[model samples]
Target: MLPRTSFPSAYRAAPTLCRRCLLRSMTARGQQSRFISTSWLEKQDEAKRKWEERAKLIEEGKIQHIWDTFKDRGYVKDLAGTEDQIKELMVQKRIGAYVGIDPTAPSLHVGHLLPLMPLFWMYINGYRAVTLVGGATARVGDPTDRLQSRVPMKKTDMTMNITKIHYQLKRIWLNVEAQATRFGYEKEPRIWNRAILNNSQWYASLSFIEVVSRLFKGMRLGPMLSRETVKRKMEKGDGMSLDEFVYPLMQAWDWWHMFRKMGVRMQIGGSDQYGNIISGIESIKYLRDTEPDPDQKLSDDLSNTPIGFTVPLLTDSSGAKFGKSSGNAVWLDQFMTSTFDLYGYFMRRPDADVENLLKLFTFLPLEEVSEIMEHHNQDPSKRHAQYALAYEVVGLIHGLEEAATVQDQHKGLFSKGGATEVSSYPTGGPPTANMASAFRVDIKLPESLVLGKSITRILYAAGLADSVTDANRLTQHQGAYVGGAPGQPAATNRGISTGELTFTPIKNWFPQDTRNFLVDGKLLILRRGKHFVRVVEVVSDAEWEASGMMYFGEPGTGRVRLLRDALMTGAKEGEGHDLSALSSPEARRDFLDRAEALYSDEAGRFKGLPSEAFMVKKTRARQILEQSFRVFARSGNQSAQAKTAAIDEVLERAARNLDGHVENYMAEKKRQEKKKIRTSRPADEKSAVRWV
Candidate 1:
């Protein structure tokens, strides 16, 4: 060891230095540190003082009315500021409020609806409503409830998602505005004040250095580290990422930007976002309090200070969260979830939850809601409350017209006396005499596949079941039904014995005399369960064979084969396959042979194949064609001239075949008519009518 005299003075004094003094020196140095500046602490004190003042106003009952509307409807779960502060800000001016949505998906789900309701209320109440799309931040991936970082989205996909979400937002706003009017909110929303912004606009130009220098300085590591999300991740040893840790800082920047530019003083989000909301409020306070001029300090003014409001997370009766993660997300986009399915989702809600759902989801008056509930409680099986809930909510999301259509469809399928058992042959005529009230067919099946096929095979072919085994299971479990009309029952019976169609349970096989089962000798309705119903129109054998041949004669078979190979080899899901591929003439011939085999019998008529087998072959052929089209289109390998020539050839053949079929059909009909006329004539006149 070196001699003490030779050591540095600080090292020599280490043993004798007092622990308290050392800690004091470190604390003093920390206060002046650049990351957590002294001014930030002062700003915290100022915020506390303002909170105390707001609390006093709240105690005085001055701010109670401000939150009453939201509280009554269960919209308010947590609020950043006291009620008085919110009241004061609203009373002073038409301040802006916003909710940010990350385009993690192309469509918003029901979970997003809770927070959005407050924004809609604000807009109609004459406040500026801002919907911020997280174009830039979505790229970062919100780490709020995730155990792992999100898979980074491709640039193209992100762009598409952003565009779709923007359109959805606009559409939803229009829907809400229309719904509000029907709910008796006469004041029209200021459409001009509603803004849909993409944060990428500013983030694209924002430099990393600028973000760190300006925004990060106001954020403290202690609070961020202590957040429930961060702490949970750390405790679980999952290891948090730097991007996730800095996510709140970016969100803070968003709020600050909106506050300064849009006069937005409020941010609304889900209760899980409480931590992020706090960070935003702190950021606004820090930036405002640090302003050089005292007169320009917005945080010092009560009305100017930003606030955050959060609604409860939407959940089921089991208390599980409602979202994609839970695998139960009900999407607002019609393409993702049809209006019929959406209406059914709410209709299926338990009686215990319907009343609360009505209160939360609809804008019907409380008195009306209570009266409806009382009536519903008297006869719960009638589902009066569920119908009201389903109708109003469906009307709100999808227009009232769509809601009405779905309602009629639902009633037609399930209402009492809507269907009658077919135990005996019809007393009068077939149900199809009055075609106006015939059940609308949702899918069309080839007659060759349906007339003698098993019920299980029909279900699989109609896309109602995943596989033949699944279809069999459904039938065995009494989950399959055949025959039901989709329109309201006719008021007049006419010659028909039953004015309403009836669904009869089907087992392993369809009836051998399927003509009696068919409506107008064509249409068949198949129901898998209470929720899934499909009406199939059985096309003639001639039409079926012609359609298959037409598909086969189409151009670009080579490209389609190549695309199918690429897809089979594990191309990414949703990858475009529009480019052309080099293929041999032999390959084209082989493809045509396979298509011909699917529908052609030894006698050259349509084959009597099971619907499942027919559909499988048809689907495989179509997939290959579609895949090829997509690949060649994307690759641009095929020349326009060649594609056009192939299309023209196919269309010419198809048209010729169609004309021949029509002529044959008309000729057969005329021969039948002549036979009828001759048979009805008297014996003496019949002998004279036989020359032709």
Candidate 2:
């Protein structure tokens, strides 16, 4: 089907704990969440109940910390810094967990959900959330998902994108916090206290030399080069530049600064960013360990050392990525990607992907997601899992109201067997296709074409059976049925048997069927059998004339597309005189052949033709060809003398308009040169020349 257009982390125990010894002692966390109905009100109530149950688990030893619970639930991927260290720190303090986002676009897309959603989790779990806008990092684009370096954005464009993303991120973060607070999850919601920092502020003051020598003093060269993002680019022979190479260094500085200044204890990112996450953690540990203290009390206290973890990148079984660079991404901001478009993207999630996407992307309980999948699998056609996934993801990002609005619009399109209201559908297609099997009615035949036209001509114009002979053979079985109009009540009443199929007009069956056969004065749908259907639209002759386009079809179907190539072939020295029409496949092919030959002859001699001769002669030639075409179209007969007359008249007017246009072009060129010379002249010389 052709598309018309559419639109977390916890910290660990103190570093004093021996890493090898504690690795064996680490206990995986678990929690039970209550299931809620699809009702929004019930879901709100369920949230409060789940929080109460979570409190019990925390006391009963079923769960170590909320961050650990998240890790065990399969949210964290490529986790860096031990679980032992992170869990201990979370238990002792409410640490700030930060995720940095570069504002390369004015809006964030679905691909960003892997990293950005962690901030929401941190807030609901009573951890401080910091969503950083990488205003500076954006200037040096992230080399994470690109094969080639990005074209730099203008300052005004970058600033605009940054400001818009700031508002979008803040809005979602605040809404999530408010919802959690209303559920009594947190009396003093940490989300209200959350921070949205911009890295440009720090980078603006920090110099390149300072970053390399001081901040990166503890960083190793081997690890930086071995990072996956860097490795892939180098192996591909499209290696990253110095600016891109040091991007992680700047990101590391982000973590180091946040750890010391704001006390952010953890950094979270997508699987692709685990390498950068590690770099930040290492740089932070180095800075913290190097901090001078007379008592040396903090030396062994990995107590508050920053730790980092990554969320698994969502992928289909084929390993095609699902987020930002996946190419099929949708923007988070409603204005950029319309509400209907964003909702539809998730609602159409492939069955194989929906189950995993539900687990990774949404806040729904994993068990509930399983239940949704069971129901979805039972009736795959119903797409219950897709709806639930779309609902939660859309509600999370765009709020419940916007989500509901889009869902309603989507249902209205497909709920009643695809575009139920004929008035609402586009002239060229259904408002929304119900399935891939639905036939598209895209061809716009001239209104004049419908009157007494043979089945062969109709089929050819509609692009259904290829040629008139093919159309005739396909209809021989009497399997054709055509009806969908004011006079015809049923969907199929007409048929063409093999004996009556040859060169017969379809209007013979229903008498005046073609007069009102078009649904809403535009569409005609015909079914060849149970499996094949085609659509034809009757368009006014004026419309076709204005467009100048010969046909609407799939690639390689446009009849006149070869006109230029044919003309080029005729330009050979010995070929110019052989102007006879070579092929005659259709009624109009002869005229087309002659027209192209004439155009080629003129074009070949274009270099030597005079302005008056070229212009006056071509003007007359156009009139002759147009009149000949009209006569041929009406009766498929144009005399040889008429074509010769067109050639002679065209020669008289070909060059009439050419000289005036050339003179005007020369005058403009001279004016521009004078302006350039005056501007380049020295100030003193320019003043003396102007006075003279």
lDDT for 617 (candidate 2): 38
Off by over 4 Å in 1: 1-66, 187-192, 292-299, 414-692
- What overall lDDT, based on C-alpha atoms, would model 2 receive against the true structure? 0.62
lDDT of 1 at 108: 85
Query: What Cα-based lDDT does every candidate model obtain?
Result: 0.67, 0.62
Candidate no. 1 TM-score: 0.54
Q: Over the stretch 345-415, how does candidate 1's per-residue lDDT look in tens digits?
A: 99999998888788788878778999999999899999999999999878777667667777887889744
Write model 2 residue lDDT over 1-692, tens digit each, in one string: 33222111133545344445344335432234456556757654565565567566776888666766576457777778888777667666567889888887767888787776767777777667888888878888889867778788765455446645665775677557645665456544222358888886676567878676677677777988988788888888488898898888788888878776766888888787877887777777776667655553244476567788888776644678865556655787655665566677788779988987887677776678889999999989989999988877777776666566667777786441223112111225422222112223234666766545655456655655545565576566544545432233322433221111111223323324554444445555554433233455667889866766554232343323243344435454543433233333352354444554565455344453433323333345445545544543454655544555455454444434545655665677778888888889999998788632
Location of the lowest summed lDDT over 10 successive residues in candidate 1: 490-499
Give the residue spans of candidate 2 off by over 4 A.
1-59, 62-64, 181-184, 187-192, 207-209, 292-300, 316-318, 323-326, 415-692
- Compute the lDDT of residue 169 as modeled in candidate 2: 72
Highest lDDT: which candidate? 1
